[model samples]
Target: MSDQLFGSWMDKRDSNWVVFAYFDWIYSSGMFIQMLECLSKRWGFGTDDVDCRFPDNNSFDVDDHFSGVEFSYGLMYDPDVVIVSDEEFGRYLDMACFKYIERTPGSAEYVRSMLSRNEPGNG
Candidate 1:
């Protein structure tokens, strides 16, 4: 297992979800377990190995207030709870990117630009 942490958007059977996953190499067993526990309490469960179908639109949205802290610690949004509307899903996706990837220097602008390009009526 690699030590790096990673995140991505996913879907299954027309259901949409987001995931931030990592191997044990990056987090100690205790810490990893704690993280999962916190996630279960806050957002939802952490899957070991799972597979699902992709969304038809292939786009998501992030809320303006979404912070990356939860995702940085490995949060997976439960499809059942997340609304399927494009605007809301896009907000969630934006939040995930901002918190997970845009934290690094010079990433915010790039991410925002990418998101804008993908938004409806923009392209």
Candidate 2:
């Protein structure tokens, strides 16, 4: 309970990375590094681009949303941790993060890609 509330799972491989209500329990053992990679990869509008953030905190941020990050955020701010995101982006990113924590990132992503092609709006 305290670990969940305070993100102590980051220090030790104590808990799985379950972000919000978008997934099943991942066998993470603190797969937090994979979470950051997944978030940066599937950030709703990936154009295979990249950017760096120099936030006040000493944490460095990177993501593929470099093409329209300013437009997405309404400012030129690259948040170290994206605590604010619109609903669709947040949900999809969470899904990817969860998948990355599993043992089969590539296969899971392939499934998602196929599903996306069949989703209503894509056609």
TM per candidate comes to: 0.35, 0.22
- Model 1: per-residue Cα lDDT over 67-111, one tens digit each: 222222223433232223445545644554455343344656655
Among all windows of ten consecutive residues in candidate 2, which has the lowest summed lDDT? 18-27
Taking the tens digit of each residue's C-alpha lDDT, what string does model 2 give over 1-123? 221222332332322221221122112234334334443443232121222121223325453233322212112345112223334444544454455535455656654554454334553
User: Which candidate achieves the best lDDT against the true structure?
Assistant: 1
| Model 2 steric clash pairs | none
Look at candidate 1 and tell me the lDDT of residue 94.
Answer: 56
Cα-based RMSD of the predictions, in order?
Answer: 13.8, 13.7
